[model samples]
Target: MLPYACAWIAKSKGFGKPRREGGFDNHDPRAWLSRLTDWQARANAAQANSFEALPFFIGAVIIAHQLAAQQAVLDILALLFVTLRVIYIAMYVAGLPTVRSAIWALALLVNVGILFLGWR
Candidate 1:
């Protein structure tokens, strides 16, 4: 959902502007996106990252559940993950790479913590 949100933002921002070879070419979306150099591009990059992060996050949650993690802790961590991701998206789109990287690291740590929630 976060990834899709990023894509939607990118597309919406791209709609009225042409950077090269026209704008938001649905026929060749990848190529069109690759040509972007603004916040739209950042959004696309963030979308890609969000997709990349999904499998790990899903796995972590599943592992936690399978291990019988405390429900409250798991839920809190999941909420924190979403919040951090939203901040990460904003930071990326705003071109704050340094802080964004920190947030990314923090989010990864949260995932790791979630993964170990039921560990003895």
Candidate 2:
């Protein structure tokens, strides 16, 4: 959702691909947050990679919990993970560095929670 939103923002801001070119424009928050500089490109790329990881991270947590024979907690953890990730992405786009960091920490906690919660 964050990645898609960023792409939309990029297109809306005219930072994304020109209709003539096959390449896309950068609609990511990093693109704008980079002060319209080259770093914007790097940031966009990094965000893209991170977004890709999100699903796998959630999936892995679910699988781990399931393998531990804890289906109920896995369901709860999946919801929490998605919720945290949404907040994290919102913080990133809003340029709230501390809040974003906190959100990330929360996400890590959720991952750990899935493991620990399943153990009991």
Candidate 3:
């Protein structure tokens, strides 16, 4: 998905404007990377980066469980995390801050739900 986003951006920016054909042009990877980094910054500021907090949340759930874990709970939380992440990223990147913040909250709540359900 990142590659696709980068490729789309490159194409839009006319990385290979004259050719307009195949083969990815190496037009300053850092530039593209910087754009993504900037997006990350925006996302972070907008609270649309809740997905970035999932790993630690999941880790906490795992540790809280310790043993006798339930796969169903994990699966549900994982699905929620991924779904909310995709939505959050799309909305945040598209400059919809309000919607993005709502999505971000939803995703964070999902993580909290996971902790509550999984830890129990």
Candidate 4:
């Protein structure tokens, strides 16, 4: 959802313009996104990273569930992960690399915690 939102925001700017006139090329969305500059480009990169992060997050949740980890704790960690990712995306689009990387690291740790939640 976040990724799509970022893409939409990026593409939205070009809405109503013909693709030949430098409008977003829905026919070649990836190519169009790759050509983006500034915050829009950062947003696209963030979208890619968000997608890259999803599998690990999903796996951690599934693992914790399979191990019967406490739902309350798992839920909190998952929520924190989501919150951090949102911050990360904002930071990315804002060109705050240091802050974004820190948030990314924190989110990764949260995912690790989730993975270990049921490791009694």
- lDDT value for candidate 2? 0.62
lDDT of 2 by residue, 8-119 (tens): 5434444445634523434453444444434334335436745875776766776676668467767788688878877776666666779878988888788776656655
Candidate 3 per-residue lDDT, tens place, 95-114, comes to 78899789878878877766
lDDT of 1 by residue, 1-120 (tens): 999999998888668667563767877889888877889889999999999999989999999999999999999999999899999999999999999999999999999999999897
Q: Which 10 consecutive residues of model 3 have the lowest summed lDDT?
A: 16-25
Please identify which of the two predictions, 1 or 2, would achieve the higher lDDT against the true structure.
1
Q: Which stretches of candidate 3 lie over 4 Å from their true place?
A: 1-51, 64-67
Cα error, residue 47 of model 3, in Å, equals 12
Off by over 4 Å in 4: none
> lDDT of model 3 at residue 30?
43
TM-score of each: 0.93, 0.60, 0.57, 0.95
For candidate 3, what is the TM-score? 0.57
**Counting only residues 3 or more apart in sequence or on different chains, how many pairs clash (N, Cα, C under 3 Å) in candidate 1?**
0
Q: What order do candidates take by TM-score, descending? A: 4, 1, 2, 3
lDDT of each: 0.92, 0.62, 0.58, 0.92
Q: Model 1 clash pairs?
A: none
Tens digits of per-residue lDDT for model 4, 23-115: 978898888888999998998888889899999999999999999999999999999999999999999999999999999999999999999
Candidate 1: worst-modelled 10 consecutive residues by lDDT:
13-22
